[model samples]
Target chain A: MAQTLILEGNEGYVLSEILKLSDAQHPTGYLSNEEYTKYFLKSVKGVSNVRKTLAQQINDPTITNVGIIVDANSKGTKARFDSIKSTLTQYLPTVENWDYVASSPAGWVADVAPSFRVGLWVMPNNKDDGYFEHFLTELIAPEDESFLAAQEMLTSIQKSKNQRFPDLRAQKALLALFLAIQEEPGMSAVTALRKGLLRHKHPAARLFVDWYENTFTLG
Target chain B: MIEHLTIKNFLAFPELEVPELKLINLVAGKNGVGKTALLEAIQLYKCSDKIGTNRLISENRKGNIIHHKDRIFASKLEINNLSMTMAVGDYKSKVFIDGEQVEGHGHPDDYPNHEYEFIRSGIKEHDWISRRWSSFVLTEKEELVTEVISKVIGLNIFRIAVTDQSIMVKIAGAKNPVNIKSLGDGLMRTFQIAMALVDSKPLASNLIGLLLIDEIETHLHHSVIRKLWKIIFEYAIKWNIQVVATTHSQDAIRQLFYEAAANESYQEKVQVLRLQIGRSGKHEVIEYPYEKLEFMMDTKLEIRGL
Candidate 1:
């Protein structure tokens, strides 16, 4: 049976983008009408803003989590987060909110299963994708400036290079960056290097699994 | 209130140690060298006690602190004056607090952090005294007040920021605003420090509290940094609050010492500890006299910062 989830966020595109990176059997899904009413419309932001329809696909019940990506720019984001958590706290077989926003920090919504809620400030959406290039060109690919530029365009959109996002929170971001590279021709030179770790196999995925087992204690 | 911090092998810089520190300790290091990691360690150190060592070990072992494999185990964390020392590793962990054992994890208040404990605490103490001493982390500038400032500092703050969103409580020129997030980072941080001073003391009494900021200077012009120093020093004298913070900005480093020398109270009480990533990836801390930092900032030697 396929698990399902209802994602909550301000940007549908970012939520959808994160769904693409999840790489779970049926782990990708969006909010249904019931969840939209319970999670979004009833919330304070929904009460204030227009109710725009979002288009994201839900595959099967295997999708156990939902990403709740938001930008730091939201006016009452803190309050809104509380609202989301509270709304879902009551659901039977509840789902967690995941994140896929750029420049934001990664957090888990374990009610369903662990996921991230990425944002701009947490990640620092500077230059959209420049830091990856900076890290690649300067740190990873020092000699080749142009090639680094390509990676910057294809790199994971996390926040400041100065700040570190725990390895546990990096699963979606790293997976997304990999998929983005596969879609673009600019990063072919670096593809061979990355392919050393098979994409479908997800060697990088272990970092997060280790995190869940270590950090989150059993109730 | 937090007396001291101690860290043991978790990731990088095994056996990293420090004595009881002053109000403001300036930590500087090369990029990817662990400046912010030190702050995270401190937050984890103190917060672990409040939350649980299980979360602490897991949070670290998850490989988020060092960005390496999650196998950086075999570690212990403790804060002096407070009893618990968190021993972290794979399969087994323990948190000994005040001579008793405890379980749980994450920020001391709540795992999954149900609510913003900092702001909730700020709101509880939002009466008269807290208005004077103001302190904050200046990442999103004005929004610091909205998102964190208003919460930790209180709703009465002239500013409030949520995530990246910030709005100043006071609109134009007014006596004071409800939220402080509307202003720039420098002004807002000063406001938090000032408010904290006032709230923690009686009028005209010197407040003996610490101000710890990750980056001492954020988004302020050099001249403005000087003015902020003047304002904070005056507040400290009037209210009797000790200021402790961190900064990588040369402008902030210079202004703090310059203002300290010009003001006697600061000269007597102020201390600046410089943290550097030494040759072996270990942290080397050097305490600089006001005059020494002044000279270095003037020379403008390129020093890599976290």
Candidate 2:
């Protein structure tokens, strides 16, 4: 019973770390944009490439479940979810209840075809206009004073005339600064999670963990 | 070309419905999924001599010609406007066309006289290739075949001659004609495929031809297969032949897509049909059109039903 989790960019590494912290059973397969650039889902060609990947996975009898995790970005949750549903419907026209499932904030998981179940999760709680960096930010230890310092540093930089980072990239820049001050400086966000610098039991993290476990039946 | 095909109670397929076929189609599936059986059904459908076709199909599997009464093979060709249902039972085989029983082995007056050639797996026997070579020599197709084989195998073939005992080929520097088999299995396989493709061309321009090749990648290197596909695609269009081949090699599938993608017109002419067994214990087909296939190939996705 092979279960695959497909992610965009370096999200696979982040999700791998999250799975390790949650003590949840990992999926059988993990695909990222690093390996399949089409998983970036940045353009029409990317989405078409992803549709082909989904078709291959759905037709595979060995794969029991497939999950896709993409950022909401500026499109928000509904539009992102709709895009995935549309791509899936092109291959599986008989699947129903997509709109009903899209109504939920927790994301959707159901058997779209015989012996084939698919799961979709738009990042940042699936109801907000943010990305993976925003999701990782929520897992920061609330009591950690350094986290507050990092936020202040980013705010002061933004207010300064010489600030180079754009407002849209503030969350990403904040995460980078937070990781830079860790015991292992210049490490990736996923490495920070691996070193226990981020709180895995945070409510936001638990919410995503719950959606993941239920979607893939990690129990 | 057969636009659509439906099979019922055929070998291994209780019921199967294939989507619209293209100029060149590659059928892929796991073992025992009936890729070969699909080709046999098409051969049976196009055969004018039912008894001979039934015996030949049985011989290919090394089985007896007699079959159970309930083991009836039925198929319908949508665009060709033909339907054939036959049962090679212990007593006698019966055939029907569009629900009308035909006497003896003769097809109906309206039956389309389409030509079909079934190339089974492995190399053809010396006599078989020799017989086909004799017929090919009678036509003006020898130079075309020699040139294609030369290009595919990287050998500068000057001429090809068939003797009573063996087939011989002369290279550019060869003092005398060498046995074709001396070149290796790749060369022989290429020659057989080229001959089949050229031989399938009908004398009448209006008549369409079908060429079924099982295990098309047999005895061929990955590089050689790509070159062979280029020629196949070219001849498929020029000769008005619809090619259907089965393969278990991923290289074969990938090369077919690459060759088709290299030519815009060939892109629409190619498709891949993956046969699978559904939860309901029935065989099903998943068609990958040219666009989808191109995407799968570009993403390096597995399309062999693995």
The candidate that wins on TM-score is 2
- Which candidate number has the best DockQ? 2
Per-residue lDDT over A95-213 for candidate 2, one digit per residue giving the tens place of the 0 to 100 score: 65556444456678888776677778788778788888898988888778878888888888888896787678788999988887777777787777877777777777877777777
* lDDT per residue (tens digit) for residues A1-219 in model 1: 112222222333222222234432222121353433332221113321111111010111122233333322323344444444444443223444433333222333343333322111111122122222121222222344443444464343444463265543353344344444544533332352354222312322232222222222211
Per-model TM values vs. the true structure:
0.36, 0.79
Error of 1 at B125 (Å): 20
- B87-192: candidate 2 lDDT, tens digit per residue: 2211233455444443232223212443577888888788888888887684679988887788788889988999898888999997998998788898988998
Residue A198, candidate 2: alpha-carbon lDDT: 75
Full-model lDDT for every candidate:
0.38, 0.72
lDDT of 1 by residue, B1-306 (tens): 233445554345454555545443455443444555566554454443545545554544343435323334233433322332332221123455545543323232222221111110122223322321233334333343333333333233444322323333543345755444344554455445444433333322321433334454555567766766675566545544434455666556667777887776566455555565432234555455555454444433222233
| Clash count for each candidate, listed in order shown | 77, 0
